[model samples]
Target chain A: MRTKRTNWLATCFLIAGSVFLLFPLYMTFMLSIKDNKEIADSVLAFPKVWRWENFITAAEKVNYWQKFKNSSIITVLTVTFTLFTNSFVAYAIKKKFDHKFFKGLYFYFISAMFVPFPIIMLPVVKLTARLGLDNLYGLILLYIVYGLSFNVLLYVGYLRSLPQELDEAAIVDGASVWQTFWKIIFPLLAPINATVAIITTVWAWNDFLLPLIMLDQESQTTLPLAQFIFQSKFGQDTNLAFASYLMAMAPLLIVYILAQKWIISGVTRGAVK
Target chain B: MKKNNFGIYLLLVLPATILFFIFHTIPAVMGIFYSFTDWNGLKPTYKMVGFINYLNVFKDKDVLDAYLFTFKFAILTTVIVNVVSLCIALALNSNIKLKNFFKGLYFMPYILSMLIVAYIFNYFFANFWIDIMGYLGIEKWMVNPLGNEKGAWLAIVFVTVWQSAAFNTVLYLAGLQTISEDLYEASALDGANKWKEFWGITFPMIAPFFTINMVLSLKGFLQVFDQVLALTGGGPFGVTRSIALLIYKNGFSGNEFAYQSANAVIYFVVIVAISLIQLRYLQKREMNL
Candidate 1:
């Protein structure tokens, strides 16, 4: 009876917390469809005339499709390249753990995790300009490289739990090192790969600062950057800004709702490990 | 054969190494090198000015204020986030209906862009809160928190904890699961009350995760930017500026590139030290357990 009572109390607390957590998102959806007079009259009221056209006008104003394409291309390429590069390096380091050079390299890569991005932000901006990479491709390359520390940490830790005999067995079958990694070991890395891919995807997709500084061209704007620019310009149009914000949030929200279980588990695994 | 094997290993690692070197290593080294010089980013020429920039960082009131505000923000957020998330994790760990739904819902904010989340709450504070307060006859509370100096940092903390607690709750839940059910049953058999069971069993079990959350939270909050940028923009007399935002503004906009580089280096050392100290103390406590 006591346990039942406590359980009821806990459930109530959780329900209240959920309401607080979801309030902003609920408001975003509500205000996205609200017109100026309706919003001015009552911020929380149901819209008398839902402005569905707000999304269309906002989309056109922000050039949503172009920015979406930029964001998608950057995120996809960053996740793909991060998985390949970080895991490949981690694999070699794991295999050669007994060697001093490989061990040192492992520490060398992971130590950068302690170095905040601001330390390197200015120089990287200058270097990217110098290298003619101050664009989307440059941002992708930066994500892959910046991600190396954490991704390698995750990969190396995962790799340590697997047996070395898997590699030896493949080598005995007359496979080269690269072939063994690709055909045998790479297939076994599905879980960590998912974790890495999810992390890199979220980061590259949602990042604003890197793109804000690096991409000088207006055409290179990602969704967040475009929303920022849009908000600064059309911020007074409450309905339009909310519409733009909701549109910025929609793709990720859809993806999260669909693959939430995998994403939660993946993120949890990344954090705890 | 040994030399050939070494070559193969090197070849496999070369691509990532080169990229890491160019992007990560070169910039880090250049940042440090530039700290000793007077390069204003746009200038092609610079002269070595030893220790002056670092000294200026000490004398700059804005930098000092930023450090104070950042540390205050980091400490407050870290403590609140850990406490709230741990409670949420505990509640979720108990027998509950729709556990998966709640878990998914809690983590949803974490996956959204911080800038976007901040914007959402900016509107909330600007409009929703004011409207509700006005309806309640609380005229004093109707002012937007973002525009008020004292309330701005608190608003940032609230938004931060709102989003970040989800991630930490997930971690704490992971920690909670590792506590064996048998242990709980055994403790229950001893007539141990819920409080005793928590302090004696649950707390110690999740201490490692507490450490993880605290360190990560502190480190991340110390470098707070996106939320501050979106919500306050370090405004209302620059009271909410974080060290990261200050560094960016100074380096990029103010043309104090080398000076901010020194600030960044100091910031890096402080972070490293804080993390190391937390890990050592927390791990030692875990050892005693």
Candidate 2:
């Protein structure tokens, strides 16, 4: 009887929380299908006529494909380079623990984590502009650089647990240091790599302020930037704006739903550590 | 072999090293240095403005309001997010069916862009919420909260906590899973009620996660920008503005780049001090425990 009561209470809490979590998403979809008249009439009511063309109009109005491509390219490159560079640095730092520079380098990255972006963001933006790096490629480089410290921390912590014998064994078998890392250490660090990859990818994908400042061209605008511009221009058109929002958010939402298990686990583990 | 190893070390480390030097290290040093200057971000010339910007930060009503508002937002968000997430974590941690489903649903918002989330909620606050309340015949329900000064701050807090609680829920759930089931069994055997069992057993064990959630959410809330920008655009007389928004406006939109750098420096120090204090307090608690 006690167990039954606890179960009932837990189920009730779970249902309430789930509704809270899911409401906005449902509303977003609902609003996307309603015209401005329908929205003003009854924003909470179901759409009388599903306006699928709202999406078509929004897509045409904004440079949806261009911005989407820009975001995808930047995210992919940022994640790939972040993983490769940070993992390699982690391997080197871990393998060369006795080396004075590696020890200093390790501590340097760790301390760097404490320096929040705003502290450095202004100067870095100015400096990057001076270097003619105020573009998408430069933005990727900034992401890679800025992304390194935290990821290196994650990788270093993970690498510490892996047996040092792996490196020694590879080196003894005539593998170079580079080969040992790329061929052996890198593969062994896949789990933590997934965590870093997902976290960094999400950050680089959702990042707005940097792109807003640096990516000045229409061609360079990311999806979020484009959405911000679109809303400011035509935000009164609720149907079109929501449709554009859905278009901006759907790809990531779909990917997350399909790969939720891995994403959730990665995020939880990443945070707890 | 030694020569090749040295080359490999440089190759592996230099990219991150050089980039960090340019991007992270130099800018950090320069942020403080520039705070002492009058570089307006456009001209190549400026004079050293000693302590003027810092003085202005304190004297300026808007900047002080930004700080106060941010503190209120961060403190409230930290408390609400942790409590809500902890409750959800406790419920989900129980022997509930569809546990994974609920967890997934809760964390769904964390992955979506804050801009997108704010935009969606902006629509609801501007239109749907008012319409629903009017339909229910509630007096003055037509007034949008995001359009009011005080209410807009609440709207920002709500959206922030809503997105963040999911992540904290995941963290707390992970922390809860670490507590041994045997401890709970023993508590139940001692005739401890649910409240006692939770306060005695579950809460203590998850205290570290509580600290983590508090510090992280506080830090994130202090830097709140994308959501505020999208939802209110610092509207209703900038009552919803954050320090980060102030930094962005002063640095980019206005010509007070160096002054904003001063603001950023102060913001950075405050964050570091607060985080360090929290960590020290939590660590001391752990020791006491």
> In model 2, which runs have C-alpha deviations exceeding 4 angstroms?
A1-6, A98-100, B1-7, B131-142
Q: What is the lDDT of residue A7 in candidate 2?
A: 73
lDDT of 1 at A47: 84
Best by TM-score: 1
Worst 10 residues of 2 chain B by lDDT: B1-10
DockQ of 2: 0.59
Q: DockQ of candidates 1 onward, in order?
A: 0.60, 0.59
Model 1 lDDT per residue over A1-273, tens place = 224334776777889999998889888888889888888787677888888999999999999999999999999999998888789899999888889999999999888888888999989999999999999999999999889888889999998888868888767777899898899999999999999998888889999889988999999999999988987898888888989999988898899999999998887777666
Give fnat for candidates 1, 2 and onward, in order.
Answer: 0.62, 0.65
lDDT per residue for candidate 1 within B1-289, as digits (tens), equals 1223677999889888988899999998999999999999898899999999999999999999999999999999999999999999999888777788888888888779899999999988987778778999999878898999888899999999998898899899989988888888888888999999999999999989888888888988988998999999998899999999998898999989999999999998999999999989989988898
Q: Which portions of model 1 show Cα errors greater than 4 Å?
A: A1-6, B1-4, B131-142
RMSD of each: 1.9, 2.4
* Candidate 2 residue-wise lDDT, B237-289, digit = tens: 98988888888887877998999899999998998899899889988886676
Chain B TM-score per candidate, please: 0.95, 0.93
